[model samples]
Target: MDSLFDVLETNNKAMMSIAITRKGQPLYSRAIGYSWYGPVKTQANTKTKYRIGSISKVFTAVMIFQLIEEGKLQLTTPLSKYYPTVPNAARITIAQMLNHSSGIHSFTADSGYTSWLTQKVTPATLLSKMMPAEFEPGTQHKYSNSNFVLLGYIIEKLEKKPYAATLKNRITGKIGLKDTYYGGKIVAANNEAYSYNWQGNWAPDTETDMSIPGGAGALVSTPADLDKFMEALFAGKLVSRASLTQMKTVEKGFGMNLFVFPFKGHTAYGHDGGIDGFRSQAAYFPADSIAIAYTANGVNTNLNNILIGVLSIVFNTPYTVPDFKTTLYKTEELDKYLGVYASTQIPLKITITKKDVVLVAQATGQSAFDLDAVAKHQFKFDPAGIEMVFDPINSQMTLKQAGREFLFTKEK
Candidate 1:
């Protein structure tokens, strides 16, 4: 797969560690980039670990089902049994939270999330952030990390142990996922990869405090371990087939934490994870008995673009690799677009500024992100699927993302 770099239009500009499995056996594995970037770079390998982020929700869901099997809980159990103070807690069921229909506001999606991302949080802190239910429980579906965080707490309450210990005693130990566990501060000496985002070079990304993510995210693993977890979970070694079916159930693209991943005529069930600058994925195709897992500590372009390229080759389908071409504009050339811009369609305001040769953009209370210049007056932040076309003459910027467009007029 060395040629994958060529097709990826990479000149060591991307980082990846991937493993493929079929019929519960390893089929392929590859690692690229450094585990620790410094004076003496430490090259990453298959054993190198990464924070799997929200993929930990799949593990959380599996444990929740296991508790149900043991008669310790039920899908219809009211969340108020554990946290009665939460708004509409009595009306929210375990199943609703599992399927993301609980209406619990996502704490991480809050505008102030970035400010405290690196600090530990208390139950009271997280509880305070759980805004009033956006809708009646089970009336609609919306993705919320608050749901999983509460579920994680419930797991601790039922199992009489911390989430990490329960994870080991229940799943990883039974399944032999040696490299998977609750994570702490990253230690390069332990082969934990530090994540980065590229501007003109790889800039170290801030590490979100582990305590804050809780069961919604906080787990470190390798691609191989993730592949193993998916294989075992799908093979009924982790949960019963009935429970697996429950996890695979979806509405509006989210399922208990499992998501619908459609490529061609094949449907794969799995989850994608991201934290700080790290990104990871694990997808299983039951029909083909194939499991694919990948982790990236650094990516210079749209990661889905990279994943599709890898999948097309694996699935034996013809694929077209895009040409990676961009024109560089001097920092001074971007001065015309620097200002606070507000949109009529969205509540948030976007501020644009340039650092060195990179054009950076920040939204309302969100973190600032660097945008790459793809063409004159056109820029993109591929990581977030955001593109901007600046009409400097009109003092306006058209923002496009996920097939939606909004016109933003710069503040005078």
Candidate 2:
């Protein structure tokens, strides 16, 4: 396991940390890259904290179940009991929200999300941003940060304490996760890494306000602590076995706050999170009594690729490290790729742009993402499994994603 990371650091400059355990015993642990890349660089280590994004939902779900065990709430509890003014609140249940069947439109998906990402939002203001339900309650499974955000508020309401206070009193303190808590501004002095994308350098990524994400995606933790949380939660130190079982109940690819991952015919239950450029994943395999966690603060490659590589190394399967090579282009060379592209089969128009030498692509009304060059006129965003081959002569592009290809023409 250690040799794989050694190879990755030698070839790839991406910054990340890892923790692996078996039956609650540490098997391996490692950290690489800088938590703060400033005048004096702060190297990230096992104790460096990162915003674990939606993994915070797992914590929120556990607290909700704790309330349920105490007879304070139920799976069928109506959102109307707490916030009746929310759209369709009267019809949504706690279970529906837990399993992402509430149809609550994710506020983060709104066009204006990036506009105010770094600013603190009041509860009422944030509530108004949740657009109307996308479907009837329990009709579909769609992950929505709004669901867990509301659930977080509901937890505070029931506990009669602030979310942070309740978190300490209930979860982190119990598990001895001193590094995990509701997040704030990225404080490098505190060993919290500022997230970054690979743009010529490790360019800082946008930071969302902690107040807005609530229980949905606002918690800072280290990889080691994350592994501990998973171990303790599964060992019945956090919630009752019945509650844990309920939380693990899978429906339509989502559990209460958990997601299912299958590896080599073995089932692993865990969650992944992303906010800013930071990405994290934590998984627990009951069958093998194993738990693994990784927190990435800088990424130049596909996050999925890293997960697969790490898992392969852990399972002792044959593995190969990426060369992390890319062709560099002058700022002027990207001009031909700049245009609005449209496909006959899809409604969204893709706009290609460039900053300095970094190629970028953005779909209609969506945030722009940097694209890395693989070859001449060829680019890919591996995180989304997206690749685009461009024809500067024909004014066309072939977009491929999820194994489907579509030809697009540059719009006049």
Candidate 3:
């Protein structure tokens, strides 16, 4: 078994903390890198807290289950029963919110939401800004921060207490997560990790008003505390067996609070969290009695890739980091597939270039992924998880990944 600190020192430059356990016994708990990168050097430890970001959704979901146990709410209950002010509140249900089937526009999509996050705003005001529905309620799955924000409001309406107070009373306090908090007006005085963003070459500390994120991404917690929370959640400390089943039930791509990931004949349940400058992932394998939690203070780096790497190292599984080495292709080879290929129903565009493959994804922004050939006609961009399959017979191409594929036609 490799020391967690040794792995961190070798793989990551940003501050990182990891905790792993099996059958309720702690196997690894360690931290690496500086707590703050500055003139005054500060090192991190097991107690150092990082912004857990959307992992807060798991906490929010647990609270909803608590309310369900108390007979105050039902999964099938329509949102209009609580907030009649919402435009299509009657059409959306509590379960839809949990499973992210609600078509409400994610507050993160709002152009002005960023500015509002810098200044504190009440939950009601934030909800008010999201009055119009992006799509019909419960029509399809679309991850939205507004769903959790409304959930926070629903908790307050039913409990007759503030969201933060209710969270501490029902979830954090009961689970013995001392370091976790909703993190706006109330924050831990010590051992809190400052969030940083890379501006040019230097890191700058950044903060988001917790009130704005609410149940979506406001919680701050440590790796050990998160492990405890997951244990309690699955061990039936938080909800009954039936309620836990509902939480884990896969509706579309999301379960209750956690997203389901299918890997190598095993089911892994966990949530990944991300804010402006922080990224985190926590996963638990029930049958194997194994759990993994990773946290980093940088955004651009895909912690999922790091998680895969750590899992491979810990379990001694055969895993290779995707090859990111770019290969230069002749202009003639690029011209074979170079054209404006698009899907009318889905928003996707692909352009092949001599130097790179350009993907203009309307939803995820635009980026150029360097193509590396695995074979004469088969090429892929490892980092982007995209593959271009060419048809020699017809001279066409197919772009595939993430369960969605688009075909590109040659243009004259």
| TM-scores for all predictions | 0.87, 0.89, 0.77
Expressed as tens digits, the lDDT of each residue in 1-412 for candidate 1 is: 5577554425445777999888878888888887777688888899999998889899999999999999999999999999998889999999999999999999999878999999988988899999877899988998888998999999999988899999999989988999999999899988999998776677788899998888899999998989889988998998899999989988776788799899999989999999998999999999998899998888877889778888898898997766556678877898999999998899979999888888899998787888878888999887778999999999999999999999999999
Off by over 4 Å in 1: 6-13, 328-379, 386-400, 404-412
Worst window of 10 by summed lDDT in candidate 2: 4-13
Question: Could you give candidate 3's per-residue lDDT for residues 103-164 as a string of tens digits?
Answer: 87687788766666667787678767776787787788888888898898888889898888
User: What is the Å distance of residue 110 in model 3 from its true position?
Assistant: 1.4
Q: What's the candidate order when arranged by decreasing TM-score?
A: 2, 1, 3
Cα-based lDDT at residue 402, candidate 3: 67
The global Cα lDDT (0 to 1) of model 2 is 0.89
Q: Spell out the clash pairs found in candidate 3.
A: none
Model 1: which residue pairs collide?
none
lDDT of 2 by residue, 1-412 (tens): 6665665566445788999999888888999888877677788888889999989999999999999999999999999999988889989999999999998889999977889989999989988988688999998899899999999999999999999999999999988999999998888879888988765567778988899999999999988899999999999999999999989999988899888989887889999999989999999999888899999888766778778888887787778877556679999999999999999999879999999998999999887888878899999887678899999999999999888999999998
- Give Cα distance to truth, residue 278, candidate 1, Å: 1.5
* TM-score-superior candidate, 2 or 3: 2
Model 3 spans with C-alpha error above 4 angstroms: 1-13, 185-189, 198-202, 320-412
Error of 2 at 268 (Å): 0.5
Q: Where does candidate 2 stray beyond 4 Å?
A: 1-13, 327-342, 345-378, 390-397, 408-412
